[model samples]
Target: MDLQLTNKTAFITGSTSGIGFAIAKALLTEGAVVIINGRSQKNIDSAVKQLQAFVPNGKVSGIAVDFKDPSAMDAVKQKIDQLDILINNVGIYASKSFDKTTTNEWHEMFEVNLMSSVKLSKYFLPKMKANNWGRIIFISSECAQLVPEDLIAYSATKAAIQALSRGLAQTTKGSNVSVNTLAPGSTLTESAQEYIKNQAIIEHRSEEDVADDFFKKVRTSSLLQRFTQPKEIADMAVFLASPLSSATNGAVIKVDGGSIPGIV
Candidate 1:
């Protein structure tokens, strides 16, 4: 389980917390150099401090840039030249009826969710190709296939990412560079934990009861029948980012606890 990732440089977007942060920690555990990104220096510094506590001597750094800004990638380029692994994990969503989702909302989701990966890949994929070794992982979601009514815009962006990832992998052909997507199910991140806690208080029920209702009523197809932990998703992401996963290119690997039914 060495992952052979020592000294590998990884950059994860939106990694100040949640699954992105978990991925950064996992990579650091494998002895990889990680540069985490967030919108502000305060968040990045906090996350880096927490990561160093977990991985003691881990090499970690941060880049604070808002991917929503068109000029954000330019700032990133100035900070780092190349990467052995690039994880497009930053995303935002609004849970609302499709009709109520405005044009600006749709544009914003696409810009943050899909275009961020597009921009990052456009810049780094060639560098990886030239170096003849790299891994690009797009953090997609099960919503892409489930297409829940409340998350149509978000789901659309995730679906687009799958196509984008596969096409990018095709360009790698015979190179050591690989492009792949991971579709995770409802994971219990910090935000999700707060949501459960809030719902429990509102419903006058225990947090456990609220979580049970989420699986039974909201995500009825989940075989796991509970919220997945961020670490679960991060474990798979770190593996995919490693040189050990060289043969897994162009695949939409699911760590969705069987919420996505049927064999592919």
Candidate 2:
């Protein structure tokens, strides 16, 4: 089915790999012009090349500016003058005890995860409202509701981002612009695989055993009993970024494999 997204432009932050890259691929496949972001030129080039190889004739470009830098958005604005979709996907996470997490880490989490969305939304939401059409998706996590002990700061920032998305959606009342949050469960990204490998080696367990332990013990609420693939989450994001999802605004849709228990 056509998503009716031909020629529409989208900018996805932190799109060098994992879920972000997956979203870029999905959007490009749907015939959207996609601009990807990463911290370094090498990463941006690599991701763009991979995306082009995956979707020949797809219009794709890249921006290499570390989101941690205060002037990063300025550089981004210079490259992208406008957009039909703005996905705030750049995020940083630190898994450690709350007490062990440094104050600097907390600040960094808020800066990259929450503040980046704030700034981007501030810039694009107005343009969207003026044009009378746009899509803004915040890539939240199930941890926002689960609030795992080791991911206190990350969880807090995710929850705050959802709130921010809802508030921004409210501003788009009576318009075609929509802002929503997509909450995902733990997915097997390259970094996550490395972490799993390290844990398996440290505990003298097989890789499969380590992943099983994660769902069985740590993520007991996960009904799927496995990792949610990056593409799985990307599918939802691509829809939300399209004109088809016009009715879904100010909502928190979960692609969390039932890890977030609720009826709402």
lDDT (C-alpha, whole model) for all candidates: 0.95, 0.94
lDDT tens readout by residue for model 2, 88-171:
999999989999999999999999999888888888889989999999999999999999999999999999999999999899
The lDDT of model 1 is 0.95
Q: Model 1 — TM-score against the truth?
A: 0.99
- What would the per-residue lDDT of candidate 1 be over residues 139-233, giving only the tens digit for each residue? 99999999999999999999999999999999999999999999999999999999999999999999999999999899999999988999999
Q: Tell me, what's the RMSD of every candidate?
A: 0.7, 0.7
| Model 2 worst lDDT run, 10 consecutive residues | 64-73
Predicted structure with the largest lDDT when compared to the true one: 1
**Candidate 2: misplaced stretches above 4 Å?**
none
Q: Compute the lDDT of residue 188 as modeled in candidate 2.
A: 94
Q: Which stretches of candidate 1 lie over 4 Å from their true place?
A: none
Model 1: which ten-residue window has the lowest total lDDT? Answer: 67-76
Per-model TM values vs. the true structure: 0.99, 0.99
Candidate 2: how many backbone clashes? 0
User: Which residue pairs come into collision in candidate 1?
Assistant: none
Deviation of model 1 at 133, angstroms? 0.0
